[model samples]
Structure formats: C-alpha cells, structure tokens
Target: MKILLLITPSEDIVEKFRLSLKDEYIVLTAYSFEQGSDLIRPDQINLIAIDITISESDKIKSWFARHRNIQDIMWLGIVSSDISEEELGKYSSIFHEIICTPISRNRLKIAIKNIQERLDILSENKHLKLLSIAYTEKERDTESVIRLSPGPLEKAVPLFRTFTASLDLDKLIDLFLDAVTDVVGVSRISFLLYNKEDDVYRVKASRGIHPDISSRIYLTPDSGMILWLSTRGRILRRDKVEGDVVSKGILIRAFREMEVLQSVVGIPIMYEGKLLCILNLDRKITSEPYSSMELEKLFILSNYFGKAIQDIYKYNIICNQKEYTQKILERMGTGVITVNEKEEIIIFNPKAEEILKEKAADIKGRPVEVLPEPITRLIRETIRDKKAYNKHEVISEEDNLYVEVDTYGLYDISGLLIGGVILLEDISAREELSREKKKGENLQLLNELVGRMAHELRNPLVAVRTFTQLMKDRYSDPEFQDFFFSTVTGEVEKLNSLIEKLIAFAHPIEYKFDIVDLGEVLDNSLESILRAVKTSNIQLIKNYTPGIFKIRADNKQIYKAFSYILQNSFNAMQSGGTLTMNVESVLKDATIKISVKDTGRGIPPEDFKKVFDPFYTTPEKGIGLGLPLSQKIIEEHGGKVSVSSVFNHGTTLTILLPIAAQTEEEV
Candidate 1:
C-alpha cells in the first residue's frame, strides 16, 4: 500500500477521500497549504491531493527549494463547480488530475489508483537513479565508466534512465549494452533475444566482441547454457551456483560456450514464466569480481527489459502494416485517389502524382479542384449522382493528353455514401504504338515502289546489252540486223522514260482491263527473256490447254509479271539451262495455273521464306525486285504466288490467277 496526503480545509471532501482510498493507501490529512508543505518529504511523500483554492504553488516551491524528486511526484487537485475558469486552468498544469467536487467515491478511487501507478513507476526510476535529463546525453564509452561515480546506484541513475527512453528493439539493445558497460565497467558484452520461430536465442546486438564473431553465436533450446538458464532461472557465473563447480553436467559446456563469446557471466531475463533474453558479459576493466549490489542492480535491469520486449514487438507490427500499405501504393502503375464526402483528397498514390503532373504533398487533403478539370468533373459527378463510370476516355485537347478514367462511389456498411474512388490510366502511350505500326507498313510499301522502278529500268538496260552482244556474231545477217535495230530502239525508249515510270509509281497505277489472249501474253513473256539472254544453248518448253486462252484482264500487268518470272528462270543459269512454262485453265477451280520451272541454281533452304520480300537478293542476282514485283502484280489481279526449290538442282515458281470471263478471240 502507498502513503497518500490530502491538504484541504473541507471536512466533507476529506471524508470522501478517506472512503475512496481507505483500503489501498495510508491516508494523511492537512488543513491548509502551509501545513501540507511541512509534511512534504519530496522522496517519501510521492502523492499529494489538495483543494484547488488552498494550494499556492509558488509558496510550496519556495519552501522546498524546488527539489528534483519533488517535481516527479503525482499531484491531484480538487476544485468546486463554482470555481472560475482562470483558476481551474491555472491548477490544471500543476495537477495530473483535476476532479470537480463533490466527487463520487468511485471516481476518486479510480483517479487515485491511476496516480498511484504513475508514482510507483517514478519511485522505481528514482531508485535506479533516473532523476536528471542529462543521463541520456552523457558518454557511455569505457573511459566514462573509468572516470566513474563511486556508488553503484549513483552511476546507474543515468544508465537506467537511458534504458526506458527507447522502444526500438535494436536501439534499445544498444542502449542496454552501453548502460551495462557504463555501470559495470565491463570490457565486452552481447545481448541475445529469444527467436520464437527458430526456438533459439541469437545475439541481436553486441559491443566489445568482434562484429563477425558474435552474430554467429547462438543458444539452441537443447544447448548447455540455455538449458542451465532455463532450469536455474538466474544469472550464470563462471565459478558456481549452489556452491558446486561449473565443471559438472551442462554447466561445463555452458561455461565453455560463454568463454567463446568473450563472456564469463550470463544474466537471463525472464517474463511471466518464459525466458525472454540473456545479457552476456565479460570481466570488468578493474579485473575485480562483481559485488552483490552490482548483481542485484543487473537483475532489476533485466526484469525491466523482459517486459519492454513485449511492447516493442507490438509497436513493430503496427509500423510494418502501415509501411506495407505505403509500399503497395508507391509501386502501383495506375493513378489511384480516394476522397471524402466533402470532396477532399485523402489518398493520392505516386502514379497519380506522375500522371496529373502534381505533387502529392501539395494536393493531398486539398479539395478536388486541385486536379485537372476533367478529372475533377468525374469525381464530382460520381459523388453527386452516386454512380460508376468505367473506361471513360477523356481527350483533353487543351492539355493534349488522352486518358482513360474509372470512378466509383464508396459506401459504408449501412449503404450510406462515405466518399468516392477514382482510377486513371494514361492511354496516350497506346496511340504512339498505333502510329509506329502504321509507319512500318508505309515503309514496306515504299520499298516495293522503289524496287519496281529499279526492276523496270534494269530490264531495258539488259535488253540493249543483249542486242549489242548478238551484233558480234549476226552483224552481216539482214533479218537479224533489222530485228536487232528495232528492238534496241524500243529498249532505249523505255530507258528514257525511267523517270516517268517513277512518277507513275509515286501515285497509284490504274490497270486497264481488256480482252486478251493468255497464250500470246506467255509468248511475249518468253520472247522478252530470250532477247535479254547472252546464251544460245537455252531450251524453252511450253504446255498450254488446247482451247482459246482468252480472258478479260489487265494485259500489260500480266505480261510484265510473266516477263519478270521468265527472266528470273533464265538468269539462274550462266550459259545452258532449260526453261519450261506450263499454262493451264482448271475449269473446276475457275483459275489459271502458270508454272515457271528452271533447271538452274535453286534458292537455298534458308532463303525460301524470304523469296518475295522486297530487295531480298543473292550474289549475281538482278536487283532482287523481279519476283516480288511479279507477285504483287498477280495478287492485285486476284492471284497468289507459290515457290519450291531443290538446292543446286532447280527452282519452280508458280502463279495462280482467278480466271476472268472468256472472250471469243483465240490464240
């Protein structure tokens, strides 16, 4: 039971105090403030209660010389209902509690009990010498311990005060180790806490021991030292417990493990019935064995630490939960904002700050007006109408941003609207991807157009060179001379209009449909390739359906396509090669199949897939545009191209065109 003092002239108030505190405290009474000052012992009288009107704080301070211990005492003030506000406020700072009279017995008992707990903690701190604020500021190193205060209690005042200052587990261990070093003047120390998951005690923090050495040291449940600590439930010394040598069962190994950790003493801190931590210590700097008083102080400190560990873990759980939530928000890719019914921003994630170009710190907790007009409109609309909008695209012309927004109203368990949530995704990036795709398509088209122009110009140049080569042998033949001259002139005219062909390619080509003979078109294609060839041993074979091969089609385009195909077939050979043309109408399929086969160098296996890609080429091949241009022309006339090849053997290129309406003209 604690001693209590009541300083009030009111007999009725004093009677109420006695009834409330009679069972728990030694009730002492004084009639006035002057009389109470005489009873105040500063250290012994830790609790005091008085009528608010009678106590003069200045007079009491002057009489006591403002003792440090006196300030720590818990004071309770009792004031009447009619007391002025100024006086009530004045005493409020001086008292831990200000209960208005006439106070109920239960209320007085509760107030006094709370103050009693405070006073008990204050008394314990004083006993540990936690009186002055300067305790935490003092150096806790070895030298400070050497320049020591004589009494153990006097040296402990600052160290014990430092103990209660932190709730952080790691920092608290550091302080505890430092305090032990300061008070006990030990050369080395290590603090270990029990890990529930591992069922072992591991060093959480340490001093004096090598940094790498202590963390690796631990005590398992079955370890000799842990077993001893669990059974003994007290500090372990190197010499003996109950006057037996530590060289016996368990103690021998326990002492050995402690020696490895640079410790000769181990103090086990237990809470309730469980061991919470162990404080391992080496010898003192003075090389003297610990006194009984020093051991007693350590036990007191260890008891306090066991309780502190529980509180620290509780604090960490709450802090971790909040930190985990913050990390999730920081990592999200979408802008997220939550608001209250008053239209104030409560939560603004990092993505919101980036997308809106606004700082979260500046805009959070502010009204929705701080956001862009479109975003604010959505928030207001959702809150006012209590509806949800999904995938709402907002093209902000003035801000020049394309954004997709989603908004929903938030509600309570009772179905009343509490606030609203807004989600934003910037879809402008998708627009950029779409543009890049279009640009790639346009680039491919340009490649084909340029490739077509190169193919046209190269064909005429090859013809002029072939005719000139034939002149070397047939210059004296009249028939060959006339045909050569006419062909050469026609080839030169086509070369002169190369620039015009380019202009035609720059725009779109309009194919003119006409009634034409398909057999004549194949003959003209074979003749063009024969004129371009410099070889004489080349053989041509043709297979055509026995009928009038007439169709409504673009005659020039079909001729140009066949001419390039035959040219490719002949160009595959250097001197002697056989070129076969197979043209047939499949009446069942309603199509024309033209197969161009060459007994020349075939395309490699790897190059087969890229045969029709514009500008794809091989060594000594003509500009690589012939086949792609031919394929494009056939496809424009509703046809498809196919290829098959055998390396070094031969290559076959086939064209399939939708057979158009038949005409009366036959070839």
Candidate 2:
C-alpha cells in the first residue's frame, strides 16, 4: 500500500517508475541514494522500489543496508539484465523480492500484498500487549476493593450490640478474631491482645494454623514479627522479610508452619492511638504472591477492623453503665423519665409508670406534655432554664401522686441541648421522714436553747445568792449594801448578753432577698473574720476576682453561710496553712461559682455525702449545724453545694449559684 522510490541520475528511468506505480501506490521519489535515504520514514514507507540502472547502484546498495538498520523495510530492488547474480545475492537479505528491467505491474502488486500482511501482524501484536497491561491494572484495582471492603463483623450491628453488652474479655477477643478472618478472607489468623498489667502480649485466639503452633507463639516486646510491627506501625510483606538474611530464620519457620510459601501481609490494629494488636494473613492457598494491590487492600481493611474493635470495647462499657443504671433505677423509690429533643418519651421506668398510673407501652412514644399539667410545666421550665429545677411536694390532681419533681437538661458532647431528664420522687413516705428529721432538729435546737437559758438564769441566781450572803455577813451595814447593789447590777448586765444570743437563735429571720454581688459579700466576710481573729500566725489568703457575680439571695443569709464555712476552714488550719478562696463567673452555664478550699485535715470519704445532714460533725466542740444551715441557705437561692475531699490532704467546697439579672455595670 506504501512505496519508496530510489531515483538514479537517469531521469528517464525515474519517470517511467513513477508513472507506472503512481495510480496503484503512494510513490515517494528521490534522485540519489543520499536523497532517498533522507526521505525514508519507517512508519510511512512500507515498500521501496529502486532503479538500479544508474551509475550509483553500489552506493544505493550501501544505503539500503544502512536504512535497514533503522527499521525492517520490505525492499524491492529493480535491476537491469546486465546486473550479475552475485551482486543480487548481496541485496537478497535486505530486499524481499527482485524485479528485472522490464517490470510488470502485476509483479509489483503481488510484492506490495506480501508486505501489507506483515505490517498487519505487527500491529495486532502491539495491540495485544496494550490490552494485557490494562487487564493487569484492573485486577489490581478489584483486589484492592475486596481487601478494603468492611467485613461482615465490622459492620455487623448485632455483633456490635453483643460485644458492647458484655464485659467478658475472652468473648470479646474471640468475636474480634472471627470478624478479622471473615473480612480479610484469610482463614489463618492469630491475635495477641496486649496486657499492660503483665507487660506481655498473650495469644488469645487464632484460626487455620495448628493449635500447637499458636500455643507456642507467645510474643513480647523482644519476641517476633508482632513486636516489630507494633514498634514500627508499618506493614511487613513476607517477601521483604524473607529476603533479609537476618530475618530469614523467623520468617522461614512461620512460613513453614502456616504452609505459606509465597507471601504474607501483617497489619497493626490501633485503638485510642495505641497499638492494641496485630493481624497477619498468609498467602492464598494457590501459592501466589500478594501483589501491590492486595497489600493496599489489606491496609484499608485493617483500619476498619481497628475501628470495630474500638467500638466493641466502648459498647461493652456503655452496656455495663446501662445495667448499673437500670439496677439503681429499679430499686429507687423515685420515678424517672427521659425524653428526646422531639419531646417524645424515650424512657419511662417501672416506677414512673406506676406513679403516673400509666403503662410504659402507652406513654413511651407519646409527647412529654401528655403527662399531668404540673409535670409538663416542670419539664418546659427546665429546658428553658437549661438547669436543674426542683419542686418539692407538688401534688398532682390527675394521679393523686404526692411527688417531688427534679428536672434537668441534657446536653451532648458539643454542649448542645439534646433533651431533658425528670426524676419524680414519691414524697408520701418522705413526708414522714421529713417530720422525723424536723423533730430531731427541733430537739437539738431546744437543747441549745436550754443551755443558753440556764447560763443566763445562773448569773442572776448567783448574784442573788452572793448579795444575800453579804447582807447576812454585814447585818445592817450601809456600806456593804451599797457595794451589793453595784455587784448585782453588773451581774444583771451579764444575764442580758446571754439572753440576747438565745433570742437571736430562736427568733424568725426578717431578711429580704435582693440581687447581691458575691465578690463584695466575700470581701466583707473575709475582712470581718480577719479582724475578729487577729492572731499574728493565722494567714488569710484571698483569691477573689473583682467582678459583679450577681445572685438572687438574702445578703444576710449569704453572709452567714460564708462566715460559717470560713470559720470552719480557719479552725481546721489552726497551725495555719493556705486557706484559698476562689470566685469566678461561669458564663457558659450563666452561673457564679465560689470555692472555699483549705489545705487542712480533709473529711473522710465515707462522710463526704453525709456532711450536710443535721448534727453531723468531726470537730470536738462543733454544734454540727453549720454545713446544714449553709446548704439550706444556698438551696433557697436556687443553688447547689458540692464538696470534694481527700482524707489528710485537703477539702474543697464549691457553691454553684444562678446569676441574677445582669446590670449595666456587669455587662
């Protein structure tokens, strides 16, 4: 189909060849051997026709040999009858066929046909090579997808639920191994769960390999491939390990036992950013090397397996917590309900259903507003306030349930409002408890009142007895009588002081509630305490921030609460250690918190929760009423008292109070 013409200096012969082949072929004509060689392009020239009658025939032959080195070309040498057979023999290797001086058109067509078939075969071979490369790439991609796809156990919801629901260590490990084997498509699997307590990695579970091999394969920081992978966090291909002479012994033994002659892949399972275990898969049963694609798939699959393991562990923790919470809720005398953001009831415990006279099945999917009016209002208020609200002894007319409702807002990880939780405590039995508590409080108050009363009465009585004895001794002496009158007046003044203290404790408080600043109150209280206890050894450390921490409370009551806590701290640090007072504004919760910490003898852990109860004290001479009274005052102001203490180390008492309406100065 393609032609290259070698034209000699004889213009007549060049014209004859071009005219004859011009219609049947694409003709390229060159006047000299040098010119023809320059025109030849292997990709374009499929056939060459030379006119050898010219004087440069020998030079033409040499050019053909040189051009043949460039590419395989079908050369058709045209020679005269005078050309010898020996000369033709030299051109035979380079030319496919020879045409004599009287060249026929049919002979030329036959030669062209033979060259066309050769070109077609070459083209077909090139195309087949390209297709082979494409198929290799496709197989690699598919192997990667299979290796990386989430395994049955990885995405298995029921497996996750079961794993999370139990704390049995052995079961958790077994389930993990099963998932890895199923997903990785490798029957030969082994796990070594690291035990920090023992500083060793124990072979917990394995599949495919002999039990004896797994039993002997215990790993430590110094042991085997697992230890290396843990420290490196890189996948170790079997070929790379086997090729290293230093690692040959270990790799050889492992390969021999697993019957994996070709290759293996090892991946580390990381949890909480720490290497928890390693998973290794042997070569396929067909003894084929795991290509680069398979290795990449293993990497992706291992990441998912790691995540599943972490989820299973977290599931178990939440399961335990849920169980503990259920037990506590069932035994509690209070009714509890949890609702989601849509206000639909998510949880209605047995106690809640019984107290409301409704079944859980009927109320679970219902809105929270479906409950009694008081309960609905409580929940709405709590969500609006974004804080806990307590209403004591609120009688619900619908159910005739005398319950104390405590509602609090629930928040998610990002501090976004999720829903609310309500605890309904039945106060029918609590009323009796309250009555008994009140009786005990009154009895204790009475005892203190009686002691003060006796102290006051004794002073006057003593004075009277002394005056009588003086009168009896002096008989009718005017000077002794005057002295007795002066002494009796002084004693009467002492009796008045005792009577005033008794009256102050017994009388009702006539205090008014207003927006008071915590910083100012604390400063004043501290100044008063420092002035009252003017001992050179007692140091008062004030760590108060000068900001208006506004709270709705009785100023006098708050002052009294601060005084009691400060007094206790001062007493505890008799030898004088640091008494830290911390005050700050918590803007996120819209609350003001004040902390009074003492580096003194701390309360015992067992007594931490009981410290607020009336008449519970650790001090030798304490009346045991300070903490209880402080708690009551804060509670009245819509706040909470929390104490964290460590025995013999220190104690911290934190008071969380709602911030009142902000003034222009505060803003």
Candidate 3:
C-alpha cells in the first residue's frame, strides 16, 4: 500500500479528482505549493500528481528537482492539451505520466504499474552486480592468504633439498638471516664477508636494517670488538663484556645510533680454519639480552652453515644437471617410456602422455600388461632377447594413427639388465601420405588416357568437319544449308568440351567455406602427391605444430592449392630430391606460415617473382597455372605466397595466412 499526494489551486481539479480517485491509495490534497511542501513526506508518498494550471506549479517542480528523496517518487502532471513542445519535453523526463484536463483513473493505474516494474528490474541488476564483486573479492583474499603466509626460510628449505651440487650465495645468506632471526628472536641481522684487499669485513647483505646502517657499517682489524674476536674466532656477546668495553666500543656506538638498545651477538663463519664472514645479530628497542642456550645454538648453526657454503659449487652443479635433464625429457617430440624388470612403468614423459592419451600419474608404476597388445608384445620381446627391437605399428584406435616404435633393454653402468625403454614416433600422416601418392599415380594414368582419348576423337572430328563443308558447298537449298551449319557448330563445341576436361584435372572447381585445420589439409595433399613421386627417389619430411591450426576456409580449394605446390616440387625434382614441409603459427605476426623447401634444380633468381604470374612457365613442358592458382587461393584467404631460390642449390616456397579470429575457448 502506498500514498498519493495531489496539489492544485483549481476547483475543477479538486472536484474531478474527488470523484475519480482510487480507494486503494491513501490520498492527500494541498491547495498551494507552500502547503504541499510542508505536507509532503518522502517515505510515505509513492506518487505525486500536480496540476500545471496552478500558479505555484513551477515552484513545486523546482522543489521536486532539487530534493533527491522526493525525486524517486513517481510524478504525474495535469496539463492542458495545448502544452508547448519545449515544456512537454522538459516535463516528460521528470513525470511518469500526464493527464489531460479530463483525468482518467485507468491511465493513472497503468502508468504506476509500468514505473514499478522498471524499478524492480533496476533493483535486481544492482543486486547481481554486488554479488559478482563480492565473489571476486573473496577469490583475491584467498590467493593473498596462500601467497603471504610462508616465511622465507620455510620456502628456501625445499630448494636446498632439490640441490645437486651448487647454491646461490645471495639466496643462502637471506635464508640464513631468516633462520637466525626466527631462532634467536632478533629484530636485525647482517652478514659481513671478509674483503681481504679492503682489509675489512664489508656488509654483503642485511635484514630489518635501514639503508644508511647497511651502507655505513664495516669492521676492520683496528675495530675494538672485531679485533677481540679475530684472535679466537669465537662468538662475542655485548652483555658478557665489561660495561665500559660494551658502551665505549665503536660497534656499540654504531648499534646505538641505529636504535639497537639491549644487546648484540657476533658469530664468525669459518671454512678450513680460515675466517670467511661474521653474522651479527642485534636486540633492538628491547632490554632482552642473548641467552646462553641461544649462543650454543648459534655456534652449531654457524658450523653447519660454513660446511654448506663450502659445498655450494657442488650443489649448484647437481641442480643444473637435474634441470637440464628434466628439460630435455619434457621437450622431446618422441614418446619415451621406461619399465623396470617387473614390467611396471617407471618413467612416462609428456610426449608419452600425449601419444597414449593418458596421464603420467595414472600410468607410472603400472604393469606393461595395461598397455595395448602390440606395444606389450614389443616390450616383452625386447626384455626377453636382452637386445634392441624396432617395429612399425598401426593403431586404428583413432583415425589414421600409425607409429614406429623402438624398444631396447636398459642397462646399468655394469652392463647388467635393469629395465626396458620404449620410444614412439607418430607416422600416421606419413602413411596416409603414401596412399595419396598412389592416388596421384592413378591421376597421372587418367591424364595419359585423356590424352589418348583426345587423339582418338580428333579423327572423327576432322571427318565431321570435312563432310559438313562438302554438304554446304553442294547444297544451296536453305533448309539443307542451315542443318549443315548447325551440325558443324555442334561438332566444334564437342571438341571444346574435351579440351576443358583436360584442364579440369589440373585445376579443381570453386569450393564453399568451412572451418578446417590447415595442418590436416597439408598432410592430405602431401599424401596424394607422395604416391606419384615414391619411385622417383624423392623423400618427404613434414614438421607441423601440435596445437590449434583451425581457419575458416574452403577445405577443397586449400587442398588443391597445396597439391599444386607439392606437384610442382615433384616436377622440379624429376631425378630425385628431398622435400621438407614445415607448418607453424607466429602469434606476434598473427599469421601461420607453411614453408615448402625442396632440394632440386632450383628456379633462377630472375624468374622467381614471375613464377606466380598467370600462364608463366620456365620449363618447356610446364603448364604454368599451378603457382598462379595457388597464389590466387592464398590471396583470397587474406594471405600471401612468396618464394626464394638459389640456382642449383634449392628453392623454398612460403605461404602466410591470417589466423582466424576465434572465441577464448576455441583459441
């Protein structure tokens, strides 16, 4: 239930509203703006209806505009039909409804319902935004707790455990400071390593100290406390010394200036009976002195720390070697798996996980029996023979999957059998490529048949032309002459169709667009071309990236373009050659590059640029449309085709295409 306030000085409005006003609303009436201002209660009033004919209506509008609390209430204006456009526009923004001279109760109810619905929607939106912000803040808080809770020493211990031979000195010092600070309960610590040339122990690192203190403090042979410690290489505590010695020494004076009030302890780190560095700890702004137990622990820690420091080079060497080996295993393109004598998996690298489509954690320590029959048999054979074995295995678990697996018995340095190792190289695409090459051979045979077919049709074509000419010359009759001309035209058209059929074998028809993987298209094209060149003594190598290679393109047209380029390479390498195809995405350039390099009789430099021109051919028997058609297809996909060659060396052709824009998940 809500209240409505009505204001007007007109008798007619009062009379009309008195009769038509709804009973559900708690209505209040004011005859003047001053009366209405005093009567209005923002919390109680949900709607306001003001008659513009009243002399005080402008003053009422001004108050409503200025008071934000009142502005939220739905407003209605009672105006004459002749209200000017400018005034109407001004009031439209402020008022939810307008009533003409004759007020209708139904119209007022509808307006109120509409405004309430809009307000409800706005409230819901605000609520949702608040919830989103709250969730985001909760996530940030959780991350902050995890990141900042651990102490420096706690974090460094793991790094120490993983060490092989060497250690980072700076990191070691920081960790030592943290350990000492936690154990000794000191506010400040500094490590001053002996600098022989300077004849002083200079500050190498410090914790919880002002920049000025770190920069200025140093100990030389003449310094009081340092000189006293030099002779014995023992721990020194300020409280144990005579009061005068404690207060008057240069070290004490420096510590006082830095606001270290209670006490100080110095422990020297020695290696092979030679002084290395001094660890200085200070009790600052507190009256606590170093305890006997703290001093005992400090000596033991210093001894351990000294030995660790001496072996740092060894630790670093071990760490580096481990990292190097791990990086190699992770980055290898071949799948590597190792099994112990019990035939249980011991090592599974990333490539192994990818090829097998299983996680290392799930497979490691699992028996070889869990593997497929072919792979299991191969592993068993190698283990039994105590020798190396190699085999090509076709896995039809997925479409077009072929792999070459090499298995060998693993041995210890003593030449004793310990385990077995399996290496897998995917050759599915290569196998498919062999099939495509066979298809190319068939296409070549078809081409030869077409040529013979053209020769066979030529004799009949000639006879038809000669016979038609004779008929046209012998018969002047209009109907007979027309029939002869038509027959000759139809025969000529048939010959033209035959020539078109020949060209069709070389260039395919236009294609529709599709979302396709460019890498797959390249593999398919090479497979087709490989069959024709297999006996030509040519070798094909393909290097393609393993991730998203999708692009919006006409798959058939792109396949045709790739085929033409591959065929051209085959033609150039008639005797024998090697073709390398590499496909990789360049994110910074926002493009993908497909490079086809051939070791063949290379194109001359002068004709390199002209190779893509229409009908441009260097070889006497060349059709010249291959490169031009490839260029057209690439350009149509918002890409470019380029070539580089050195005479008698080789030629490399590159095609760059824009990567298709995709949504986050698709990318």
Superposed Cα deviation of residue 222, candidate 3 (Å): 17
User: What's the lDDT for all of these models?
Assistant: 0.77, 0.67, 0.70
Off by over 4 Å in 3: 1-265, 270-278, 282-297, 305-328, 390-400, 413-416, 442-667
RMSD, model 1, all Cα superposed?
A: 20.3
Candidate 1 versus the native: TM-score? 0.39
Worst 10 residues of 1 by lDDT: 129-138
Best by TM-score: 1
Model 3 root mean square deviation, Cα atoms: 35.4
Model 2: how far residue 429 lies from native, Å: 2.1
Let me know the TM-score candidate 3 reaches against the reference structure. 0.31
Off by over 4 Å in 1: 1-172, 194-200, 204-216, 228-234, 237-240, 243-253, 262-264, 270-276, 283-296, 303-327, 339-347, 377-420, 427-667
**Model 2, 1-667: lDDT tens per residue?**
3455555566665666677667556667776677777887763465676666654656666766677775546667777767778887876665677767666667656666676677567644543332232222235435432223333434444555555465566776677667645644564766666767777766667778777767665555555565456655567665454346445665455444323312266666665446776666765553445555345445544555566667756777899899998998777777999888778888898899878888889999888888988888777776777767777457755567688888888999999889999998877667768879999989986796566556547858887787887687795788887888877876776466345433434465556899787788888777767765535476556666545567788998888778767766776677767888877768899887889998778888887777775445455324445666677677777888888888888788899999886554442
Q: Which is the better candidate, 1 or 3, if ranked by TM-score?
A: 1
**Superior candidate under lDDT, 1 versus 3:** 1
lDDT of 3 by residue, 351-467 (tens): 887877779899889998877677788888878777676775647654334678988998899998889999988776777898799899888756865565655467558867686
Candidate 3: lDDT of 401? 44
- Give the winner by lDDT: 1
Question: How high is each candidate's TM-score?
Answer: 0.39, 0.36, 0.31
Stronger candidate by TM-score (2 vs 3)? 2
In model 2, where is the ten-residue run with the lowest total lDDT?
A: 128-137
